[model samples]
Target: MDIDAWWGIIGQARAAVGDRADDRDSPDDPLPGALVDVLAVLEPADIIDFYVKHIEVTDAAERYPLMWASFLIEGSVSGDGFMDFRDGLALLGRETFSRAVADPDSLADLPVVVRMSRDEGGWIGFEALSLPITDAYRRVRGETDTLRAAVEAAIDGMTRPERPGGGTWDPEDDDAMRLHLPRLAALFLD
Candidate 1:
């Protein structure tokens, strides 16, 4: 699937589940469930395309400023938590995700982040809206036939840089965080 096709599934899921980016109470809740319903009807190949495009989209989003913004909003977090952070952004759908990719600090304007700043946001990460697609395909294609090789090959063929192409910086540098994400830092750190 292309970007629009990839986002189509994500958009449908979000609309089904209702802005679930911060709903820590139920991590997957109805979103992943909705995805399961959507992906179930797709031809197996389409599922593969959806997942590959998901990686591509999320990879493009992994820039320094975005990462910094994640740290600011979530704080002292990493591993699966960080993955969920990006998923949280992705879960918001294309317009919000694109805005965030273009301007990480722009997140402060979002009500979800605003709630999060005050410890009211539910949680982060929607697993990049991937699980249901994979599960759907695997069920059709069979277990141990995750199509992992095909997905990895497509990703490998892409010109992925070691880091997302924005310039790098220490995420711990308070000055850098404040400088690059003044609005976000203000909300999260204050």
Candidate 2:
């Protein structure tokens, strides 16, 4: 699968979904807007292939730390939690959902991911969240090969040095994570 083509498809989907977001007074479930957009443009098989290739290239635990952090925050807010949010994506089938996340840009369309990325201290939790998300994705895909395990182990090995101290954010120290809660909640509440 050509990743560039997949990227283009994802871009088109985001624009299409953004257009829909503009038309509505408020969308009930904006999280999957990008996924819906992608499905409209690409075949499910192609999407899966794109996703597997994407994951093969990107180091979810290292390269895109902020995106991973944003995903966890989004999950927490949505009541899906990290694993459930991943499972929900997996519902798109192993490949579509996995590939969707492999592209960091696709995550921007997710309300919580966007909000968290903009948060002042969101990086505080990036180290804490990245590995688990990557692990979950691999687990969901049933990736148990030696190479997969080795890669995950390498990522895990880096965790300690990468985040020396406790990497969690103190709510009082930085409430940026929750600053947009009201706006996000209002989107669903109405």
Candidate 3:
């Protein structure tokens, strides 16, 4: 979506939600209103695209997930080891991850850095008992999956609903019925 339009929608939703303009330091900070508004307008696929494009994901599959997971779970880390990495990200549990993924209403509660690390093949990897992705790592990874699922769910929710009597709304359905009716009447008929 266009940034200006996204900002306008974000501003309106933020206003509706009683969000204070002065509270945030930057757009990245938890502008709860903007987060909800933007997610509401943008598709899940788009969110994933944004994440994948903006993050400089490395081809080093072995190190990348650990790095991403460490930053997300522990905030920061100095040295490198699978054990140290696992220990750092041990706090994030599965349900916490699930809410991050499933609930658009709970977007503000999400961690500051929410990105994903994937292998070249695109298969999501998180085994609970393996040599790596140990209990802690797996939990955080599951949480990442939760975020992905939530974004997808939001995208799915944005589609126009089925009509009352029988049929579903199609791509050609006019915004006059789907959105702009009241605004049109207020400008012209009022």
Q: Which consecutive 10 residues in model 1 have the weakest lDDT in total?
A: 19-28
TM-score of each: 0.86, 0.32, 0.22
Candidate 2, residues 35-125: lDDT per residue as tens digits?
Answer: 4444434443444444454344333322222333334445332222433444333322334444455442344355434445455221112
User: Where does candidate 3 stray beyond 4 Å?
Assistant: 25-30, 49-190
| Cα distance off (Å), candidate 3, residue 129 | 32
Ranking by lDDT: 1, 2, 3
2 against 3, candidate with superior lDDT: 2
Ranking by TM-score: 1, 2, 3
Pairs of residues clashing in candidate 1: 22-122, 22-123, 24-122, 84-125
lDDT of 1 by residue, 6-109 (tens): 88887787777775533544734776767767776888778888778777777778787787787787775565555667776777779988999899889988
- Clashing residue pairs in candidate 2 are 51-99
> For each candidate, what is the lDDT?
0.74, 0.38, 0.31
Q: All candidates: CA RMSD in angstroms? A: 2.3, 11.4, 21.3
For candidate 2, the lDDT comes to 0.38
Q: What overall lDDT, based on C-alpha atoms, would model 1 receive against the true structure?
A: 0.74
Ten residues in a row with the worst lDDT in model 2?
121-130
- Candidate 3 lDDT, 20-117, residue by residue in tens: 33222243433333334444444444444433321111111123323333333333434344333322122122333234223212322333322222
